[model samples]
Target chain A: MNKKSMYGRTARKIGCYAALLILAVIFMFPLYWFFLNSFKSYEQLFQFPPKFWVWPFRLVNYLEAYMYPAFDFGQMMKNSAIITITSVIGAVLSSSVVAFGFSRIRWRGRDQVFVLVILTMIIPTEIVLTPLYLIYSKLGLLNTWFPVIAPFFFAKPFYTFMLRQSMMGIPVEMDESAIVDGCNVWQRFTHIILPQVKPTVLAVVIMAMQDQWNNYLEPLIFINSNSKQTISVGLTFFSGMNATEWNLVFAGAVMVALPILIIFVFFQKYFIQGVVVSGVKG
Target chain B: MKKYTVKEKRAIRQGLLFISPWLAGVIGFTLIPLLLAFGISLTDYNFLTKPRFVGLENYITMFAKDPLIWKSLGITFLYAIISVPLQLVFGFLLANLLNQKLKGIVAFRTLFYAPCLVAVVSSTLLWKQMLETEFGIINYLLGLIGIGKVSWLGQTGTIIASVVFISLWQSGKMIIINLSGLQAIPTAYYEAADLDGCSRWRQVFYITLPMMSPTIFMNLLIGLIGAFKTFTQIKILTDGGPSNASLVYMLYIYKTAFTNYKLGYANAMSILLFVIVGILTVFVFRTSNKWVHYGSE
Candidate 1:
């Protein structure tokens, strides 16, 4: 009976692994296909029966994709980098300050205001899109990165909430000890509080970077000029203009996804933690 | 009330100072835009023309005369209803699988979660090509299996289903969350059940299900809201094609505001969407007490 049960357990383990292997292939197929096709020439790309492997890989597809006249991939990458970096920094710092207030300080009406901040997460951005557009246009921020990046300087509700939750986990005695040591609020926040929540801050930064890097709609609306376009909108235009060039389209898609892919792979821990934290709160 | 001391006053002032950026953001970004959106919803505005007062006309037209509104809402509801449960179930299964203490589990976790890292436009474009009726690998494979070609994104019947399938392909985030939830479950419960001679299936049914109900409920709520707001994929894949078969609510609102230049009408539609989502969220919360098992209980 013991031997039979052990055999059954081993078989179940093998079954689980096999099922996971198959599901992983399915999950990763789109990406695998994109990478394969990005290296194929036009003739091989449209071949009947769909060649999974092609001879004499066309590495020039990447060059052509980058130099496509309708959208300059180099300029777009620069724009995306600047916007993502600055916005992410602004978002993390400002939200951390606000989160510090909510978590560390004892103040009247703090909880009530925090509730309002959380409520903003439920309010869909579509409801405010038009008015925001009007506001941006009126302020002459149209066709500029300001519309996309400026808001991060103010606290974002989701990041603020996440950081606040992380900060709350730290003991209040830390702040009290800092105060006794002649540290003011800012000093305590910078010296004591910030170091303790560094992991959460890193998670927020990575998340903000991903969001800003992949952001499409805001850039599509705000950046009318081709030169100002980010990678996401630029790739859309590139694909639109070269609808039939599947190789170039695939190349562009790969390029647009590369930065975030690298970041995600390297910071896998923080990325997973951020996602889990956000979901577990719900 | 007791008289305020200097230290208390100083702390209050410092606290306010720390959160001033958020205070400014709430006023300038969220509150003002919301109020302005409400005002816009009550007017006849296009970008070229100044907005003129037309009190409740847009809302009336939406509820009373607009067939597209109802049609889009139906589509959105269908998308949410179908996709949310599909994602929750698939994510939960994958999470359970990944929760095992096997060798190389981390590699499997990364492999499963990598798809969620793909950008929206890239994934949508990739799927659009893959789902093509002719010369698409999916169809070719189907033919090899002795099945006929399936127009994955071409027909009205299958368009929404195709979108849901694509959406479910990126359920890695949900899986991660569920894995975390699974890990949070104490092992003592399972051991106790084992001592009782309870089967694995029974242990899962009773222990895992009840313990994970809160996480599952949260995913359901988020999935519904997110599925309703899905835009970039549908916009790029079909653009509400095959006679608006996959015109989810946000896409409809987007087309109205940007493509047709009907800003006021779009605002009204958006307000309607807000109310619908708000009502649904509250309904879920109210009902959650019946299903979700808190630790205290």
Candidate 2:
């Protein structure tokens, strides 16, 4: 009986590991495929038995893809950086201010305004796509970064919700003590609320960076000029007319994804904390 | 120095003043755009043409005449229903496994989440290559296993599955969030269950699951919302092709506005979609009260 039970336990252990191994493989396949194809020569991309490893590896594909674009790769990266950084700043600053008001201030119509802000969460961007496009056109903001950047000035409902929760988590006595010492509301916010909610702000910044960096549709729709295109929009240039350059596309993808992946690797703890804190009240 | 009553009122006013920047953005950008979109949806508005007041014509056509509208809606719902639940389940299971204080947890978490951070165009193109019938690694792998070649994106039946698979591949964030949720649950509950001689399965069903319900509910809500807005993946990978079998609602709306130049029709569709999203979200939130557990309570 003891031997039979031990066999059963061993089988369960094998089953558990087997299940995990299969899942990890499935999850990792595309990334592996990505790295493999990025190194393959154009001729080798379509070969049968699909060269699992790109042996006799070629570096020309990366060189060719980057150099062919007049090395706008740097410019493209710069454009993406500018948009992402500014948006992150705008999002954090505005969202924190709005969140401070919501959490700290007691005023008439405050709750009603908060409710209306949350209502904005459900309004699909697609619903406003046409009108906003038309309005942007009228305002002479089309093809410029203004349309993309302007939205961040609004205390985004999701971030506001996140910051408010973070703010509320701090003890109210901190604010009261600061106020008693002649620290006005703005000073109190800058010193007390901001410091306490730094993690939330960092989380918001990361989320903002991710969103702005990956933003494709807005750039595609708004920007007509090639010079103005963000990387997400500029990436469409990779899809060639007769054939999509599998190698070049993969290289470009690796270039684009590498930065965020690197940042995330270093900041996994904060990123996870941000998600948990945000999701709790989100 | 002044303990004046009016001074207190002035301080409150200044507080409002400080937030005026956000207020302007709210009224000028989001709220105005939303209202304008609604108004435009009611008119015969194409960008090239003047928006004449058509008075419910767009809505009527959307509801009454357009079969494709409903079909797209059905497709979006199917995609959301299938993808969201699968994401939730897989994410939860992965989170549960990873919460075991194992070595290399951070690296594994990053590996799982890295796909999502991949540039959309690059990754979508990569997926397109992978989903190819002839040169794709997916089929090559299947052949190695002695399975027949599967045309992942080429066939009508398989296209949606292909898209869903691509999405599931990028669900590292969701899994990470779920892992955090799992960790947030106190271990004492599980310990007590073990002490009571409850089976592992029973402990999960009773202790872990109920404790994690709020997080699960949030995941469901977010998954549904995000899936509904899925357009770029479709636009890049399939372009609603393989006989329009994978055309989701957002993609349909986009094509209507941009390709067909039917702005009014697209806006109508968008409003309908907004209503659908609102109704669905409210329904989920209402039902969440039944299952979501507050730790304090």
TM-score of chain A of each: 0.90, 0.88
TM-score result, candidate 1: 0.93
lDDT of 2 by residue, A121-220 (tens): 6556656777788888998999899888878877777777778777877888998999899998889989988988777787788778888898898888
List of clashing residue pairs for candidate 2 = none
Instruction: Give me the iRMSD of candidate 1, please.
Output: 2.5
Model 2 steric clash total? 0
The whole-model lDDT of each prediction reads: 0.83, 0.78
Worst 10 residues of 2 chain B by lDDT: B100-109
The local lDDT score (0 to 100) that residue B238 gets in candidate 1 is: 90
lDDT string, candidate 1, A1-282, tens digits: 489889988999999999988988888777788899899887777777898888678999999998887777899999999999999999998999999999899887788878778667666676677789999999998999998997798988878877887787788789888878999888998999998877778778876887788888888877899888898877777555335677888888888788888887888776666545443443
